[model samples]
Target: MSLGDDTGQTRIRLPEGSDGDPYGGARRGGRSSSRSLVTVVGVVVLLIAAIAFANRGGDDSAAEEGAASADSPKAAATAPSGKKPVTTKAAGIPAGFTHDREGAQSAAANYAVVLGSAEMFTKARRDAILRSIIVPDRVADFEAELDKAYTPEFNKNVGLNEDGTTPKDFTFVSRTSPIGTKVTESSADTATVEVWCSGLLGLAGESSTNPVTSSWFTITIQLEWTSGDWKIVTHSQKDGPSPVPGDERASSADEMAKAVQEYGGFTYAR
Candidate 1:
């Protein structure tokens, strides 16, 4: 390096090299790399957006399916308000319930539960209860039969009082809960229904002869919709495919009584 005295400018000299491409198009390579990175980021964004859209669509489909199931043929047909009064005469009696097939079925089903209830084994309350549900014409016959069936001997067999009462210091728990309902047949004026039910009938008390027990049964009822509601013309029952026993400790009479008093029964509809 040397300095020029005219303006004190410094200069340097080097060996000569081959001439190559000018304008330094190497900037294009950097730009290309940046473009590739942007493309990758854009693809990732698109993928995330697509996934979100798919999940939202799936949720909507599930909601629609749930709504459809609640309104399906089985539910609709079994519901109580399907038709007008369907009346049928039974056993020389002008006994006909409403043709509200579903309503009739439901009433018959629930009435079966009420009739077979432990309450029906009693005298004073039983007749009143039956009169409320049974065909007005057949109420007397049903009451008479039930009274005869719940005899003193039968009470002893079930460890109850001869007067159709729970023994002193004992708690009786008898209940029926419907598992499901089905209509086997339906016409303009008649329908047959089957109701599957689980029930409990037993004594719960310390030193109680009849400790709490449960039973499973299904009841089938032939119903005719008459007047304004469902009434049973016939009812039948059979044993069940019962569950294995559980090892829960039984409650005392006082506890059972208190629980029953606190709990309420449902006014079941089809």
Candidate 2:
């Protein structure tokens, strides 16, 4: 976890976007087979991978983009870069943001992914993420606040061990998907961008008390142009661009588990 780690400008054409119960039956159906259920499970897993988890979910209030700021920045066409960018990670989170507005939005989206990650519940990885992505002076404060929020009780509610480990035979999945990013305000030294996100959180093992479920949220990041890069100064989330629950039959626990294993997680850069 020593210092060092690090994305390219990915154009999403402005579009987007796991969690589970093991043996228990609820809205997630019976142990019995249903094609619709399996399809739903499969689709959610793949969507997380494809829809851009970097802009993953947040609190319900995040769905509200607030009144448009009078000073908001214009939406500039994302400059086409001939340079293929290489990704770097510091302490596992993407590092070294660029000096432009696209770079700032990219950093915000990637930061949202890491922030909504399961690692954020653990002290070491959380520290690493904060240290790598946050403005230097704010790291300690953010760490302290997160430590409080990710308390042991919270871990239990989310089906993690006291230390945030997934129980044996279970894979814990918590991911944020960024639908898109818009720059509301920007300057040479400061910027604010809204990342529309969707997230999944829960345990993906048999008989898990807390099953994975999806949430819709938004993350607004205030970034500073520091050390030749955009670093997060502060960020907050609110809930939902949530859609009405579909009438489609829900997936069974087994189907959800199988899908989690068959698919792999993604490394979001834009």
Candidate 3:
């Protein structure tokens, strides 16, 4: 008895000296095995062909969708609006945004840039900026708040003179670049937007206490349709969805100063 033999099953023993081929002949046995192999191969080939056909159909669908996307206007969710950016300026800042959600977002983003700029350190420019962007009812309050905030002590702390002037030899670098904007809430006459920003600030000089550094922040702006344009009712800022610092060589003081002088900030953003 073999290890796998079933003791309860019946068995037939062939005559002595008979060929051991189960199909009674070697040729027949070989044929039976070949047929089994062919059947298995046929099934496998059919499965592969079916899979290839399904995948090819899926590819055609995807290609058609991509072509349609290329031919038609981009969906508002995935792309910026096609409306023209504001061409007008008031008080040296971009103004006259369209009366819509996109306009609100654009206004908010540009306002964030100017509000964070070096000009805001000076009282005269800061007041002008506030008057241009803030709603009429809020302008006085905003000016008063910012007046207390950009004090002489604060200016000195950030490497500026008490009067908000750069040192004789050093160049002051304070600029904000809006990364993106989103409207969180909206209506026919009001919108609330968030502007993600990256800012450069500090003094560009070899002997300066504060070297130029980058910071990330988000500004939330509440806006209203006022005087045929969007104006800020209130705005506040919070620190960053910051990314880890990259390993790049730092520029020399002269290089930093020259770059700041040569590279101008944008007038509009969206």
What lDDT does each candidate get? 0.66, 0.75, 0.85
Sorted on TM-score, best first, the list reads: 3, 2, 1
1-270 per-residue lDDT for model 3 (tens digits): 111146743233323346665544534468766765676566668768998887785778778778875436434442665566788999889999989888898899899999899999999889999999999989999999999999999999999999999999999999999887878899999999988899999999989999999999999999999999999999999999899999999999999999999988775545
Question: Which tens-of-lDDT digit does each residue in 106-195 have in candidate 2?
Answer: 788788988888778778878988888888999999988988999889898889998887789887888888877778899988999988
1-270, model 1: which lDDT tens digit per residue?
232357754332222334443433334568766765676566668768998887785778778777885437664554554444324433211233444555656666566667667777778778777656565777788777877888899887777888878877777777887766777887875677877788877777778777656687778887655555556566788887577878888666667767776987665555
Overlapping backbone residue pairs in candidate 3 total 0
Candidate 2's error at 59, in angstroms?
A: 45
lDDT preference between candidates 2 and 3, better one: 3
Each prediction's TM-score against the native?
A: 0.60, 0.67, 0.71
**Top candidate when judged by TM-score against the true structure:** 3
Q: Where does candidate 2 stray beyond 4 Å?
A: 1-86, 267-270
- Tell me the TM-score of model 3: 0.71
